[model samples]
Target: MKAKVVALLCFLNLCWLLIGGGVFSALEWQHESAERVSFEDTRSRLLQNYSCLTEEEVTNFIRAIVTATNAGLTLDNSTASDTSNWDFGNSVFFSSTVISTIGYGHISPSTYGGQAFLVPYALIGIPLCGLMLNGIGENIGNFITKKKEQYKKRWSKKVSDRTAEVLVMLILFLLFLVFLVLIPSAIFLALEGWSYHISIYYSFVTLTTIGFGDYVPGQNSAQRVVYRLAILCWFMIGLSWMAVILNQVSTFLTDIGVKAQTAREERKKKKEGDVGEEGEENKAAEDEENWGSTKSAKQSNVELRNMTPIES
Candidate 1:
């Protein structure tokens, strides 16, 4: 039941990240819009008496052409067409475009409604997403730990120096990284007709979680979520691969053998040291667990104060 609850919460958090990130991401990406335009109401007034063309007349003529074509699109809905500053819909779009790093530069918590919605939304959303990702990442880390042990065991019987095996694996990883990730990304950019630099930037930004929102996939709303999900896959794989690399580095540092007690002790010490550093916080959180049924509340408090911090 607990696992189900946790998983459901995680799934909901992931969905919220997807939706919010999609909208917010779209807004920041607005700055990189491909086209710019200037809309003026004077085009109609100028065109009423003027029919001849001069060197400077070309500017007025072009405005007349645009004015005739747009008719009411610009006049009736001026704010909608206005590109002077970032707009609300654009801001919402900016958030949902990336995983995190939502940039609502144009529409912060300024208005009464904006303040009412944004503050609690952000406070809950950020931690929920963080918790969800970390919970999922723990599973990936466990998988990596197992894979590392398997590799060590496989190499232990025949290989004299584990260094050579690690090097070989690193080489294989590099090859896979290039072929599986980089090449496909290149092909995607080429096929999509996006700039090579922007594509690469998106790929790296997505995997690293830096998500500057300078670039994103699927310009249109219809398939943007799909693009984000594809990018999420990249993040997951990159993280898993990083864990594999970290395990290799750790293996080199710790002697690879049946009896490497010193390495185990060192790792344990590091874990304990980290817990020691968080001693006060941990004790405060778990204070209720320290008590017995018979103890008075005041006495329990005194005992708890005297107790030393320990790790889970």
Candidate 2:
């Protein structure tokens, strides 16, 4: 039964992921289409006002701007310059995002070869990242379990195991919130000169792998290399922290469910046992009535037989 429940939960989770992905994709497409239409309208109005360039020239110029943005390049019109996308520091940052599944997507591969490589790279990298995070989470969970046990032994007092587990999980979660979210938000606020609220929003979004791309670090910063490296480190650690919290929560919920299942089975068995006892008692009472009836009939036959013998 526990296995069945776990399987059902997993199936539901997968379905949810698929549904969410589909909805978000559709919404994104609609948003992009609307933005494109609005942009064209604005461009037409501006062109009408200026009358300095033909429609074809303006269209070509807009296409060039879009192309440059897609390639992570800057336009100067004098010469083509190398994009920061392929730099060592930014490459490392991008790799971390891919493996972690954050995928901010502010920068993306423009070449067919790069795009082809990305699929296989993510396939291999995502699972590797998961394995690493799972290992870390398991180790931390084990350590906490050991400590709880030792504490109980030392105190020699009765403590609810569930309570202890919940407390430990809460502590771990608080620590993650402080270190991963709060501290990072403060640092980003200081370094990026963003408002505190926005910094917090960005940190949460990045750590949660939402990666909305509304705000990205190191885009125009002078310390691009250092900023990218720092962001990568922060996200990697945050991912592991989240993994640990999730593992603990999963384990905690599973344990509760198993206990509830066991209790249910016990109650069912007890009810079945009571029913069997009642059935046995009913059968015994019926046998007793039959025995009494048989004895009475025999006694009557004996009396009749004795009375008839004397006359004969």
Candidate 3:
């Protein structure tokens, strides 16, 4: 039954991912197509303006720019020469995100040695990070459970046990949203000059480890180190909170499946028991009828013998 439940969950998750893919494609395809056409038009205009530049040279130049861009190079003439990605702050951010499984695509290792090291680095670090997150989540869950128990004890008459549990969870969820998600989002909106909605979106994407790379903070080199530390702390707590929520949801689903399976088994056993009892009653009635018929036949035989003796 557990296997079946797990398989069903996997299938549903796959279907959900497929649906997301289709919807995103439908939403973004036209914009992507337009961008491609615009890029091609720009290339043509550039070639027309520069008669000396051959197509091969243009292609090579464009490839070089793209390569640099993907490798986290800043091309701005003002600070480009002074800026370095391998600095202490950026490296700390990179390593933390990598281990936490966020892997925001803002910057990445460009060298062969760095890339090879990344494989083992992440492989070992992800599990260790998971262990930390799990530990934090478990502690949070236990705290919530203890609080729920206390609530239930106090409101034992007014609210049911289930109702108390649900209320506690709801309150915790609201607190998390206000403190962890919405509040931080407001700060991001103010600091990053993004709209409130976009900041909220970024908060969720970062916490969920979906790191789309489209909306990263700290794009400005002038941003302070305090902001970086705050964001890192937020990521740790938010990820742990998310883990707790997911664990509870999974446990709830599994419990539902197990209860349904148990009820079905119980009903089947009851049905078999009823059938067995009915069969036993019918067999007892049949045996009683057979014994009565045999007794009557013996009585008739005795009377016949008495009548024959009188005739003699």
Candidate 4:
């Protein structure tokens, strides 16, 4: 039942990313030439309030974006009237085909409004995509942990240290984080005219819950549904993966603390045994010295003070 609900919510979210963007874009341009919307918008808002966009500010914002994304767009490719050679899936292809790197140079959104869309999609998409992958990662993490436990428990007689196993997982986790999340984000951002370091910074930002939302994906609603779903799934996966990594980290730290405590106890016992010939006072002092000077010293001092009378 829970799974079904999650799926339903995801489906709705994808639809919104598409239909919502389309509506917003249409409203955004309503204040412009009361002429018409692009074919994609026309088909989408056929029966809807395509003119709900009254605010001059929103329409200007849309125009500005179109100009920015296609600053050098010529009359043949940038303008809407040059629809003489438009492709069947011009808008759809522009948005979806980005996944395959076949960025068609024609029918580009030559307005600031359109260029603005790409920035958000990628900014949002990268981490979101990471998240989806991370979800797959978490299930994999549990499966691997369970399998390891099965083998180790089945051979319970063996004194294999869970601590050692945990360390191995940590190293592996870090490696995966670098390879999968960091590397790809770097490549994409660099290609998008971003500095390499900035790309890395962006990667860490999303994973750490520092979602500045400055960078997102799918500004173009050409394939709004696909773009939105891909990003949404990414976020889910990335978040889940982070939780698994944290759990492993916590386990690693705890294992270290436990082992350290056990070692300290063994050392204290050995020192006490070696000083058997000395007085109980000396033996106790030796035990105190064997341990750290913090808790043990304060405790020993208290015991010694009690043993000695408070002189008049």
Candidate 5:
């Protein structure tokens, strides 16, 4: 029954995935079609206004502009020696995002070499990041489990095992929330001159790996290197903290499921045992009644046999 329930859940999840994918694909197609139409209209207007350029030339020019923009290059800004996107701090930030799979994409590799390096870089870095996060999470989880055990032993009358676990999880969660989310948000607010709410939103978005690309930090700052490094550290620690929380939550849920399943099995066994006992009792009662009837019939026969004279 449990296996069937799990299979059904998996089937439902697959269906949900397919439906979501189809809806998103349709929306993307519509958006791309509209964008293409708008692009063609703009191109025609530009060609009409500037008759010197042919359609093909305008197309090539637009492609060049797009490619340069995506590559983080600025063709118009000849006087600017260095683009902020390619600076040390921003580069580090971009690299961290790539490895972490956050990919906020505010700044990206502009060169073919850089792009080529990024693929292998991420292939190596992502696994390393995963290993680091997992290791940290496991250690923290073990620590909490140990602490809970110690508490159970020390305060046998006061604290239960489940209560100790809950307390540990809550404390860890609060610590992470304050240090990784709240404090960072406050710092970002001061550094980026953003509102407190926006800072908090950005922190949550980045840590959660959503990377919506709506709000980015250190884009226009003079202290680019320091800010980017700080952000990178925040990403690392925040990701690890998130992993810890997830680990605890998963453990808690799994424990609950196991206990519930055990309880259910016990109940089922008890019910079957009750039914078996009741059947045995009924059988025993029937056997006793039959024995008593057979003995009474034999005794009547014996008594008749003893009354020989009156048997006529």
Candidate 6:
């Protein structure tokens, strides 16, 4: 049963990954192709205008720029001072995301020393963050459980305990989504000037720690310390909330699997019991028939012996 459950979960995971990959590919492929074409056209125009610049030189320059940008250096002169990735406030933001394992990938260490330090930093910090989140998630789960009991009592006459628990969990999950996910997404929409869907997508991705870093918040804002701090706090609470919900889901699946295992065992035992009873009945009947046959044979022999002198 346990093996069956594991196999089912693995299958579902694979399906989810394939579906997600397909959807993302469909959504982004054409736009990426168009961007590539535009980039090539621009390169052609640049070379045409500047006869002295070679294609190799342009490529090298672009590569350098990309490498620097990926390493969190700001090339734009206007925003470099205020919005630098290494600024104290932004560094705090980076650290929090790293520890929580969100890892937005919007910024990263540019130096060998910093990269080496990050290995140990993440090793220590991720576990600590997990411990904190688990503690918080457990508390929240306990609180929901108490509420579920209350609701269960009210719903006892109408539904089974399992049904009532499901209802309560559904309600709780909705509440958490509304407050932690939907409302926050709305706020991000307003603050970051992102479309509604993009905001929601970003919120879900961040809370789930699937951070793609494609649409990070507070990137363009010059004075974004408060925004960054608020986002960090949101990450903690939202992550904990999601953890609690997922834990409940996992518990529910495990319960279903366990019940299935128990029922199959019971069925097997009942079948064995019935077969044993039938075998005993058959053995008893056979023994009785054998006894009767022996008695009849002895009686016949006795009668023959009694009549033997007259017959001879």
- Best prediction by TM-score: 6
- Model 1, 245-309: lDDT tens per residue? 55556656555542466678999999999998799778866775656433687787788888878
Model 3 lDDT per residue over 76-136, tens place: 9986788777788888888988999888887999889989999999999999999988898
Candidate 1 lDDT (Cα, 0 to 1): 0.57
Instruction: Give the poorly placed runs of model 1, Cα more than 4 Å off.
Output: 1-99, 102-112, 158-180, 183-187, 232-312
| lDDT for residue 4 in candidate 2, whole number 0-100 | 83
lDDT per model, in order? 0.57, 0.82, 0.86, 0.60, 0.83, 0.90
- lDDT score for residue 304 of model 4: 81
Candidates in order, TM-scores: namely 0.41, 0.79, 0.89, 0.38, 0.74, 0.91
Poorest 10 consecutive residues of model 5 by lDDT?
72-81
> Cα deviation in Å at residue 283, candidate 1?
53
Task: Tell me which residue pairs clash in candidate 6.
Answer: none
Q: Model 6: residues >4 Å from true position, as ranges?
A: 1-27, 74-77
3 versus 5: better lDDT goes to: 3
Candidate 5 — what's its lDDT? 0.83
Per-prediction tally of clashes: 22, 0, 0, 32, 1, 0
Model 6 Cα lDDT, one tens digit per residue, 154-256 = 9999999889978987997899889988898999888889998999999999999999988888888655998888898899989999998898888887787
Superposition error at 239 for model 1 (Å)? 5.7
- The alpha-carbon lDDT assigned to residue 214 of candidate 3 equals 79
lDDT for each residue of candidate 2 in 150-259, tens digit (9 for 90 to 100): 76565445566677667767777888888888888888788789998999899889878898777788766777887887887787778777776787798889789889
Better of 2 and 4 by TM-score: 2
